[model samples]
Target: MRVISGTARGKRLQAPRGTDTRPITDMIKEALFNVLGSGIGGASLLDLFAGSGSVGIEALSRGARQVVFIDNSHNAVRVIRDNLNNCGFTQGFELYRNDVFRAVEILARRKTKFDYIYADPPFTVEAIFGPLLETLDRTSLLAPDGSLIIRSPRRMILPLKLKSLQEYRVNNYGESTLHYYRLI
Candidate 1:
């Protein structure tokens, strides 16, 4: 995988092998950042279920002030670390190897408030995502007026509405659907 734009444009990043990890295509990544525009600049991003740290690193490349990446797989964590180190991005990133659910719970407990929360859990695990993320909103884990961007396969059944938030846009690139949820 590679960073699609910004400071680290075209920089290569490793993706975990096997059938588990699916890196976002460069086209989709570019489109996502374009839609995000300058919103990424100086924003705090939390990449939950960070498979390859692709999205979070892209956010940083586009000038996001900081990013927190979470992934449970040892391979994913190692790749993220290597990618960050290669990009000289140590100062503004925190890589944590933890279960996505557990990390969410802990972050909520700690009152983490990020400007953007990107959730891209494995598509097959769709059933539990909505309720779990709704719980995050209920606990005020997301910052006021912040955005939650979710990438899921088109077949995944997820919520269209979340408290204080609304699904405003969806950009489809073949089998993947990138949903942009904003504060209402």
Candidate 2:
């Protein structure tokens, strides 16, 4: 994987040796940054289930002030660390090797709120999104006006109560899907 833009544009990143993470394609990354526009400047971000830390690192490169990455895998953590170091983002990042749910608990207890929250859990996690989102709400980790971006399959079902959702754009790229959401 590689950084999509900014201070560390084009820098190569390392990833776990298995299917633990699906790095975002450069095209999608570019499109994401475009959609994000100026919202990223000096914003704080959360990359839950952050595999290789690609997305978080990309946001940081593009001007996000700080990014907190949470992942439970050893290889993923190591890769994220190495990639952050390589991209010179270590100074602006926090890498937590813990369960995404538990991390949410801690961050919420700390009253940590962020401008952006990106969750790309494995396809196997599709069923837990409701509870997961509930956890986020209970923790109050998401800023009222903040956004949430979830990368999941198009076939997956989303809660209808999320109708307040500002946007639910979907893009199909090969076997994967990118789902974007924002609060109204």
Candidate 3:
């Protein structure tokens, strides 16, 4: 995969050589950023289930001030590190090789808030969808006007509204779907 725009545009990123990590495709990435528009500039982002760190790197390239990447796979973390180094990103980022939920809790405890949070868990892990949304809704990890974007299989059923988060938009790209949620 490669960066679609901004300072690191055209920089080819390395993905883990296995099925465990599914990097976002350039087309979908472009569409996502298009929807995000210029709001990405100077934003702090949380990238959950950050396989290969593609989405986080894209945010960095597009001028995000900071990005925190979380994933449970050693290989994914290694690939993310190599990709970040390759793009000459020496700062404004954090990589955590831990479970996404636990990392969220730690970030919450630190009173961290992000302008945007992107999650792309494996489609096979459908069980995580509910708890993930609930945890995020209960924590202070999301800024008051921040958004949470989740990528999942188009066929997977996700909640339209939670206690604090409400689904505002849904975009479909082939078999994948991007669900956008915001604080109610």
Candidate 4:
């Protein structure tokens, strides 16, 4: 994987060996950033099920102020760390090797807020979204106007409205789907 734009544009990133982690494709990443526009600069972001940290790294490369990456796999964590170091983003970010739900709870308890939140859990994990949305709804982890982007399989249908969040758009990229939600 590689960073698509900004300060660290074109820097190659390493992914964890095997099929355990799936990195976002360049085309989709570019399109996502295009939709994000100028909102990325100076924004704080959270990446859950971060995998190789490609998405968060891309955010940092595009001038985001800070990004928090969370993933439970040891290999994924190692790969993310190496990728961050290689991109010269040794600071301005935090990496957590823990369950995504647990990390989200801790961040919520700490009253952390992010301008953008991205979650790309394995497509087969069907039960995480509801609780995640509920937790986010009850906490201050999402800025009032911030957005949450979810990547899931095209076949699965996600909710359009969840308490404080409302679905704004859905984009299909091959077998994957991107769900864009914003706080009400």
Every candidate's lDDT: 0.84, 0.81, 0.94, 0.90
Q: Which stretches of candidate 1 lie over 4 Å from their true place?
A: none
Candidate 3 lDDT, 1-184, residue by residue in tens? 9999988999999999888888899999999999999999999999999998999999999999999999999999999999999999999999999999999999999999999999998888788888898999899688998999999999988999988999999999999999999999
Best by lDDT: 3
The TM-score obtained by model 4 is 0.96
Model 3 steric clash pairs? none
What ranking emerges by TM-score with the best candidate at the front? 3, 4, 1, 2
**Model 2 C-alpha lDDT per residue in residues 1-184, reported as the tens digit of each score:** 6897799998998878887677777777777778788889899999998998999999999899889999999899999899988988758789999999999998987889889988888877677677766666556676777877777776876553353454457666665666666655
Worst 10 residues of 3 by lDDT: 121-130
**For model 1, where is the 10-residue window of minimal lDDT?**
132-141
List candidate 3 segments past 4 Å from native: none
Task: Provide TM-scores for the models.
Answer: 0.93, 0.89, 0.98, 0.96
Q: How accurate is candidate 1 locally (lDDT)?
A: 0.84
lDDT of 4 by residue, 100-132 (tens): 888988998888999999999886667876777
